[model samples]
Target chain A: MTKPLSPGATIGILGGGQLGRMLSVAASRLGLHVHIYEPAANPPASETADRITTAPYEDHDALTAFAKDCDVITYEFENIPTEALDLLEQHRPIRPCREALRISQDRLTEKGWLADLGLQVAPFADIKDAASLDTALERIGAPAILKTRRFGYDGKGQARINAPEDAADALASLNGAPAILEGFVSFTREISVIAARGLDGRVACFDPGENVHREGILRTTTVPATIPHSLATDAVLMASRILTALDYVGVMGVELFVTDTGLVVNEIAPRVHNSGHWTQNGCQIDQFEQHIRAVAGWPLGDGKRHSDVEMENLIGEDMDRLAQIAAEPGAALHLYGKAETRPGRKMGHVNRLR
Target chain B: MTKPLSPGATIGILGGGQLGRMLSVAASRLGLHVHIYEPAANPPASETADRITTAPYEDHDALTAFAKDCDVITYEFENIPTEALDLLEQHRPIRPCREALRISQDRLTEKGWLADLGLQVAPFADIKDAASLDTALERIGAPAILKTRRFGYDGKGQARINAPEDAADALASLNGAPAILEGFVSFTREISVIAARGLDGRVACFDPGENVHREGILRTTTVPATIPHSLATDAVLMASRILTALDYVGVMGVELFVTDTGLVVNEIAPRVHNSGHWTQNGCQIDQFEQHIRAVAGWPLGDGKRHSDVEMENLIGEDMDRLAQIAAEPGAALHLYGKAETRPGRKMGHVNRLR
Candidate 1:
């Protein structure tokens, strides 16, 4: 892994969702071929990847074959099966490392690791059972969120505990899974920094994007987030510190809460995040390509934003208005090739250049 | 034909060279699949295309199957065999239409057609043999080019005549192929306009690019081409006139010779042109996506460019410098995934944003 991969090398991606689809496309831009591994039939990445293995992660043969074909392996989602990653790592190098995955996969591990690094994070308590849940809620406070320590995304696996009376119902939402109570942080806004570290340990960070959420799902991310010059510099510094501490290689999205005192890290995704989608139109190298460059052992791009952009995600039924969005002036539409339009599925996104 | 193609519809592309490879990537961004028809095995487009038919154009069955799967058919090059096009047209709509192909396939027809349209083409003469070549040289004078009427590109299939004595060698170089002698025009610089027309006949044109050639092969294209404001306007108007006249339903590259006399029509390519590669990083809608939008019956983008960019072609051994180029700040590299490097063969391109 000391030398960068040559053109025509194959990158194995685990997960064929929109992020994988985009990662595949970005790999193609660099003359790299992508082989996608996903259990779903005709996943979105299938349309863009050079090859796709539609087999469950539990299938050892498929995972081995995918790893054998790739020079490097990466994943779009952090919660990949530990056994599968264990097998693939034996065949080829898995980027961002298993350490990043182990930490980011669970809220408790990520919070504790960040706190150890002297990075401010939300106050939290781990709860393993009903008795522990009540004790954690009392310590964290009534106005808090009880979330499963693992496999939670887009507001799923969490319930609000507005008061002590609501604790039982919030715990019910977890359905006996181990949870963590995270006390709310009073911040002016949410912002995310898409940062990447190359094999040589050099880190590059895109301008943080101000995020707006609807129903707990990311709705829009605007680049050049409205903030003071010092805070913006602090936000990028915080991301670089994390990338350096983790010895990370690949793009990571660091979600931060902008408080009056300083920036508080809300969460970290070990792969490309929807908040960085504006980079597709605003910068020379995008988050997807940055991730590919990192995993492929290529030199990192100097992440510089050339234009202000606002990226809006097209959630499920938002696709019904595809024609309208396509015809809108200054709209660059990117749609995921999904056959079904369920209520919460991410259909695609559009970046409007300003 | 009136309705725009929906997400997930397939676009059948003829030729799987670098142009087709890029076209496939662009179609994917719009949620469309690409099926490439190529005679060569393991073409560059194979990495990005959803499907590829590795059969020669002579195979009507393969052509038929490809067309049957695609909602619309478009080509990356103009010289597709007539019989193959004839068979594919019966199954699905072929865009840019047969008229554009007919006019651009031969030097004689293109020159005559442009002249007939009252466009300012260079002085030229038709040569069917050595005798005709002699007659044409007498009329057009020395300092002309003798080119094969069909299949000429990248300075191939043509010979230069610096003086009347050079005429015989020029004609001999054609090997009795029907030829045309184009008299040299005294132009300050070469510029090209990338324009597109939708199914409804609406036309949109990107800014003209100034081209620099090395040994008659395009080496670089810089947008915001050095030219008077009025001439730039005139260039777009001229391109719009041609797309309108042919009822063209895809993107076209109109090369113009900018002179003291004004812009002279040099040549026209009926597909995405290499000169338009700058748009990939400069504009919201690039030439490939614009071409896809045209043939797919979607509305054309505004064709606005937000950045000034210079696009350099990676030809032959230029690829050996990949690592150096990849590390350059503000440089966006696009490799065609071509395995072998041959002299004059396009391997990829790099767009540098300014």
Candidate 2:
């Protein structure tokens, strides 16, 4: 991994969702071919990837073949099976490293790790059972969120507590799995910074994008966020600290809560995040390409924004407006090739250049 | 052909070169898939295309199968064999139509067609043999270029006649094939306009880019060409006239010679051209996407340039500068995945934003 990958090298991607789809396109742009490993047939990324292995993550044969063909391995989602990653890493280097994944995959570990860096995160308590849930609720406060320590995203495996009376029901819903109760932070808005740390340890960060979520799903991300310039600089510094701490290589998405006092990190994704999609239209090099460059051990591109952009997610039925969106001037539509339109599914997104 | 192609429809691209590779990427961005038909195995576009048919154009069965899978067919190059196109059009529609290909494939027909339209083309004569070559040299005079009537590109299949004595050698260099002799125009600069005409006959043109050539191969394309505003307007109008006359349905590149009196029509490419590569970084919707939209019957995306950009081609050993170029701020690199590099071969290109 000391030398940059030559053009025509194969990059192995563990997931074949839209992020992987975009990643494949970016890899192709750099003359790097991608081999996608996903269980579903004709996954979104299969359309652009050079090769695809349709097998479950637990299948050792498929994993071995995929690893054997790749110059380097990366994953689109952080929730990849630990056993699968351990196997892949034995054959080829897994970028952003296994340490980043281990921390970001579990809520308790992620929160504790961030807090250890003297960073401001919401106050939280770990709960393993009903008795612990009551104690944690008492310590964290009544208005809190109880989330499973692992495999929780988009409001799944999460329940809100209005008071102590809800603790029993929340613990029962978790079925005694390890969880964390986080007291809600009073914040003005939510924003995310997408930064890439190259193999050379140099970090480049795009302008933080202000985010709006509807029903716990990201709705829109607007650049030139309402945050003051000073606050924006602080956000970038905090993100750099996280990247440095992880000894990270490749793009990482850091979500922050803008409060009256300062910015508080909510969470961090070890791969490309939805909020950074605006960069595809707003910058010379996009987040996907930034991630690819970092993973390929190439120099990180300049992550400077060149124009104002607003990105709106076309979730599920929202894709029905495809024609209308296409007809809109300056709107760049990116639709994932998913056949079914299940509610809340991120079918695609559109970046409108202003 | 009347209705706009629905998202997820497959676009059949005729060639598997860099243009087709980029066209596949653009088609994927719009939720459409691309099936590339290429005679060579592991062609550049094969990395990103959803499907690829690897067989010579003479294989009628392969062409039929490719057309059957695609909703609409478009080509990356103009010289696709007529027999293959004839078979493809039977199963699917070929956009930019057969007329554009028929006229553009032959230098004699293309020049005749342009001159008949009351356009300003260079003084020219058709040379069918050595006798015709001598007669054409006498009429067009020395200081002319003798080019094969078909399949000449990147300065190949061409010879220059400096004086009357050089006419025989120039015609001999063409191997007695049908040729054309054209007197060189005294122009200040070479510029190209990339335009698209939709199914409904609506046309959108990008600002012209000034071109610089090295050994007759394009080296760089700089947007905001050093031309008067009125002349730029005329360039767009001239491009529109060509598209209208052809009843074209796809992107076309119209190369022009900016002279003291007016612009002269140099040539026309019925697909995405090298000079338009700058739009990839300078505009929200690029020439590749515009071509896909025109063929898919979707409304064209905005073609207006938002940033000043200089696009330089990475030909042959120019790829040795990948590290240095990738490190440059605001430079976006695009590499064609060709395993071997040869002099005059287009390996990739870089678009630097100013």
In the range B1-354, model 2's lDDT, one tens digit per residue, is 689998879999999999999999999988888999999999999988889999999999898999999999999999899999989888999998999999999988999999999999999998887787788878888899999999999899999999988988888888878888999899999999999999989999999999999998999999999899999999999999999999999999999999987999999999999999999999999999999999999999758889999999999989888889988868999999999999889999999986
After superposing candidate 1, which stretches have Cα over 4 Å from the reference? none
Taking the tens digit of each residue's C-alpha lDDT, what string does model 1 give over A1-354? 678999989999999999999999999999898999999999899988999999999999999999999999999999899999999999999998999999999999999999999999999998887788788877878799999999999999999989888888888888888788899999999999999999999999999999999999999999889998899999999999999998999999999999977999999999999999999999999999999999999998899999999999999889989999989858999988888889988999999986
Whole-model alpha-carbon lDDT for candidate 2: 0.93
lDDT of 1 by residue, B164-218 (tens): 7887787777788888889999999999999999998999999999999999899
If scored against the real structure, what TM-score would every candidate get?
A: 0.99, 0.99
Candidate 1 retains true contacts at a fraction of 0.81
Give lDDT: candidate 2, residue A299.
93
What local lDDT does model 2 show for residue A353? 79
Q: What's the C-alpha lDDT at position B209 in model 1?
A: 98
